[model samples]
Target chain A: MPYLIWALMRDCMPRRWWFGFFAGLLLATVLSFDTNLGAHSLGSYLAYVSVFPLVLLFRCGWVLQQRTSQGWPHQEKLRDSRGYKAPLVEFFGLSTLLLIIYVCASIPCWWNPYPSPPASAGYYPVTIHFGANDYWLFDLHSPVPASSTLLLTLDWSQVQNPEQDVWIQDPNGRKLQAIPGELLRWPLSPAEAKEGKMALHSLPKVGVELRRPLTRLEIPRPGMQQGPHLLLLQFLFFWPLFAMLLAWHRRGKLSGTLSAWTCFALGSLAAMPMQATDLDSGPLALLARAVLLLKLALPPVEGLLAAGARMERLAFTSAATSISGWLVLGALSLWLACKEKRPVQP
Target chain B: MSTATALILDNLVLHRGGKRLLGPLSLNLAAGQKGYLAGGNGAGKTTLMETICGFLPTVEGRIQTATPLGYVPQEPLFPLHLHCQDYLTQLFHLGCNRSMNCTQAVQEALHRFQLAAYGKHPIARLSRGWRQRLNLAQAWLGNPQLLLLDEPQTALDPEGMDCLQAAIQQTTAAVLIVAPEKSGCSKLAPLLGTLSVEAPCLI
Candidate 1:
């Protein structure tokens, strides 16, 4: 009973600690507004258990030493188990309230959530068909200084003659010669195509364009700009966040500082919806502008992937905000663990 | 080992590192008993004291404490953010098992330990000797039935040692000191009713 009473009052008694705790919660809420307790929270809670309790226990033990004749109060309120019960109940009640508030504040982050990407930025595989003398046009919509690589897989099922050839070119009108050895459709029998053994890619990383005739594929050249500067991806979310984190890491100071880097990493993985940003001008650019504004207003959380079904929307920025609690807690764990030995900032 | 005994160790064994540190020992401490915990450096003096305080698990025997136990380890560490006054107030509430006026308790502890000026200071800001003083001051808050001082002289200055002695004299609980030298514990000679270490170590 004495032990139980002692345990209850130790945390409650520390005004500064409670102040720190509440301040942390408020900061996390305003910055992230994320409270879904998931694996990250569990991981962080486990870390909290592993880190802070020991020092608290050690300090409590240090204080509990018997040195003076000053003993427990003789007051009747302290004499029985009844005196400590109210505070214990109050502590439990406070805990529940905190949990509720933590959850309540995070609900807004999910309301009208932004679309997160399905992974790191990369090329998505797709298929296209062409008519006689037909070619494909490739348009890239990017908010950052990003480029794409194309892979051209020939539809061998439509081929009858091995002598058939196609041309390739860039928007600059430079033509790529058709390498005879690069065509694999010549060797495979139609029966092989029937068996699905001949379905193969011609040398890949090709761009498709209809205007250039046979050399229709176009890949973005270096130094290419889709639109005027500051139209997208430059002023906000992606560029600045990435640049700051990268600069910090490069200064040779972030050795074991996993928290800040994790934030950058998670944010980088976040994605925005690309439903209409398929062109450089007109409606696509307008859609891109609106999305840029949306991302600025909202933290673009991944669509609820609670199941693997949501994996497509999981991008870096969304992951960062969604797990911001775990990130902050993890950083706090580091701070507490390193407070005595070294300096750590979350 | 009657139910009224303040502390009892019946065939208690303490094991660490896959080896028995001390064990197959039995002893009883009556209320208000005082004893010197005399043992070699490798002896489980601190371990046994910590076990009695419920900080450790007994590997091989049954032990009992009839009253609330207070313990101070050899080295004291305080969180940087906690204020000395707050520490004392919390100690008072926990010690007395009730939340009453903590001002008096805090003042009394600060005065007793000569820490009145440092009361507002954070625990992290204090020097080592001051930290030990603060640690000793905590023991004076709740009148504990049993006090275990493991190497209480580790970081104490002469004045701090005197403060520790004064604090011990005020307690009615049994105090079992684990000290290396006689001079280190010389002040407690008046209350040092017995000098002993009953636990034997295997390695």
Candidate 2:
């Protein structure tokens, strides 16, 4: 019984956790034998014959050593002989340190959902409000760069107060510089953004056009842009090249790493479609159901292959909006495997 | 060259870290001919094999092959917690076209390698020897026309090696075994051909 519980905790706990698992299992097994007199008749024989319990205990210990300890039993002394702690442990610790730093740089503290406001209040409080009609549009074009027009399609019920003049602003919180005849209304809406009848706002004469309707504004500091840019710079220009160099230094594992990255790339790409398609209703839900059925009936190998092919076909005709849990799990597993010293072969 | 040549490398040159490993070399493997590659570590034996298997890029070589190739890399890196049966089945299905014949062939190969008991064992729990056998089994799953093995016998005992040699001999496809160490080269069965590292043909 201890072993069964340990097996259940294989990923979450290892040898260090064995004591609690063992005690719990022992209690359960004893209780079972005490309560069920019929099972007790042959229970001793069954318990003696069952090796899974012992195997599970040993396996848990092995996993603990592999996951939490410094090195393999044979490799521990070798590491000490080199006048250092276990290289595997040290490497992981150091990499984890660096990763924490990297993660900190990427943290979107501004996007955290904490500090909820009362229903009547805003988080930071919208600093400005503006409404624009034909007269306001004309004022915007005049003060801005050129002539402008208002192309209103969406129901403006929220901002229908005709008495007040509304300000039109850019993402940087700067008032948009409008050009003459900047707005154009079209009856047919592009399939990209589903909201029909888009209001076109173009910085005309300068040859720049806004692809999407401007409805919201959020100011971005130059420092924020630079933070992401620097992160990208390090990722694209430094870390990958460094990893390649390190791979060469540890030439023993290059092929494995390459294969692992290939799996990651493929999985990430395949996950895109599943992430994009909306599976809430219509034929899409039927297709999702078919995929689910195939997955349950066929082996994972065949199922993944068929699903990939089916997705390829659907990609040409439809778009995906949400990824299945399986793809997310696969991608996360691959990423974790990549961070390890070994390659993950599927 | 006759159509029997399953693979041909012409004027092959490989470079690692700006150092030339093997270069100005040429070789050919006719269909169904079993060949061996013997060399010291870092002598570019694996490099040459990887280039042939299309895993490594070529610097100044032209390799011509007319059939699908199967390769067993020197190291075995199995995914975590996967049962042996499922692992082999995955490899089998990968090589299988919609027919699923390779799936049965994978099972047969596993039985031949004395791994039937471990058919259900998780590959993660296996010893290095068992892992090596699983690697070799994956290569043979499809009975590919061209098979490349890198340090194929590193973890095998004598009998295990003999079983592999038998598989190579029984195969109707061409074989290229990259043996980095020359210690065990003499024990191969009489049917397979051997080539020394210093062969004039490779140069």
Worst 10 residues of 1 chain A by lDDT: A222-231
Model 2 has a DockQ score of 0.03
Q: Write the per-residue lDDT of candidate 2 for residues A225-281, one digit (tens) a residue.
A: 232333322222212222222232233233323433433333334323232244687
The per-model DockQ list reads 0.03, 0.03
> What global local distance difference test value does model 1 have?
0.45
Question: What DockQ does candidate 1 score?
Answer: 0.03
Candidate 2 docking: what grade? incorrect
